[model samples]
Target: MYAVDSPPTPARSPQTPPAQHAKPVRRRSQREARVAWLLSLPTLVILIAMLAYPLYRMIVLSFQNMRLKELFSGATPPWAGFDQYTKALTDGVFWGVVGRTAAFTVVSVSLSVLAGLGIALLMRRVHSKVRIFMMVAMMFVWALPQLVAAQSFRWLTDSDFGVLNYVLTKLGLDYATHSWFVNPWEGWTVITVLVVWAGIPFLAISLSAGLTQVPKELLEAATVDGATPWQALRNITLPILKPLLTIVTTLSVIWNFGLFTQNWALRDGHPEPVYQTLATFSYTQAFGRSNYSYGSAIAVITVLLMLGVMIFYIRQMFKIGEVD
Candidate 1:
């Protein structure tokens, strides 16, 4: 070999990895992902148990001819397919109840929001002590259970011994012992009032929070620009409050649309089928008539409606983000 001095070969090092021998970055990322999922496993399990499981069961029940007798006899409830859904969708009474529910929700939500807005505005203008009292009163009412509130309505409207009847009698309305439930208007009025009252505190508190975010400078500037308070509210306050309004009203619709405890409790004393809202109607079919599948179908429809509200709420949140 021509001893042409080959350049001294560089020493191979143990510390530095060659390009082909590099650590697996993707492997590390996958491991981190697995660790994160493991950490969240408990919450995932809870949600599956509480929310997902029931939803799955309901959907299953809605498609099958479920009955208490079938379960007790250990007999399989056959797949009814769309029979329950067909019945629910075709029933004139069901459709009427749905119409009433929509009207009820509209009235209750509108009045509650308006009342809350009024209260919020008044609180802003009132002395601190008066504002505190109003807030406390609203909170106290909100703290009452819906069942208890419904019972209170019953007591207040009792034909024989109601406080309201007593007051009306004292005011010289001789027919003050009114069978309130007999009249659709009166029964719905009580329900509407209950829903409105129940909804006001949340709406008021939220609107107050919205109010805080509204710059005083804007109001003052509007006044400087010769805008009346009403005009300023119509133009500036409402535009700024659109997001809050959308959220509150949508939530209220969801809550009121599916109201069960209060509606059931209020009508328990009488049990009028005509007085049924969608929630009570579902209850009637499920337990009252032992038609579980049909009830579940109704429940599925209600869930779909609420899901629409949820989707609306999420879209609104995204829109707000884009605006910001």
Candidate 2:
């Protein structure tokens, strides 16, 4: 009989791997990814509820012409279509306030940074007990509430019964008894002094922390090479601390830009347009004038401007990081 023709065995491609018979790896990878997202779901929800929600609401409110009266009235507020933004951009008073705020931020932040750096440097060489005492004092000052600090400043600089003037009078400097909160220059002086005082402690503490991370040998080597203390600090300490300095300075700028309670209290409720910052301006518009939408626009603008400045500083910090 003719050899029985058997059905030819299905030819398997030689290039095909035996592993192809196993389950798909992609499915496992996707399952792992799902598990990861599930694990992080709580944190994501918290962030969305806190940061993202407020930000979204603020942006939405900015485009609405919602006045204060309608805030609690449950009305469908009309769309403003950038009307408030246009008004704020064109308003001379708003521009003036912005200019003043910029100047204030620059001067106040500079002074705070310089003072804090100086204090930090001094702390590095001080006795243990002295350092502890200094730290405690600074912490106390920093811990004081803004309202209390502002009030204390008012009392300390009071025109008539102020302790500062009383001491000055004893020293025969009668001019020191003049009011510090009436004239624009004097008021600003008082405000700057207080703000700088309050801000220095935090900056100094952060700098001190960064200082400890610096290699002591580098500083010693610089000194051994006939470098003066200042030269050693400039060449060694500062180079190492640049990233930290950028971070601290950026934070100070952010804090100072929105200085409200201290400044508002300094004005003693007689807030003038000349001295108002974008923050105070927003508050006045929202609460004082009951113009919620316009105030929201101001708030949005302030956040954008702050973000712009912060991004510049953060980029510098990241550049340093990359170099390292």
Scored by TM-score, the top model is 1
Off by over 4 Å in 2: 1-47, 312-324
Q: lDDT for each of the candidates?
A: 0.85, 0.87
Per residue, candidate 1 scores C-alpha lDDT tens digits across 131-218 of 8898899899889998899999889888888999899889888856678888889888888888898899999988987888789999
- Per-model TM-score versus the true fold: 0.84, 0.81
Question: What tens-digit string does per-residue lDDT give for candidate 2 at 197-229?
Answer: 999999998899889988989888877889998
RMSD of 2: 10.3
Residue pairs in candidate 1 whose N, alpha carbon or C atoms collide under 3 angstroms: none
In candidate 1, how many Å is residue 199 off? Answer: 1.0
How much is 263 displaced in model 1, in angstroms? 2.1
Q: What is the C-alpha RMSD of each candidate to the true structure, in Å?
A: 9.9, 10.3
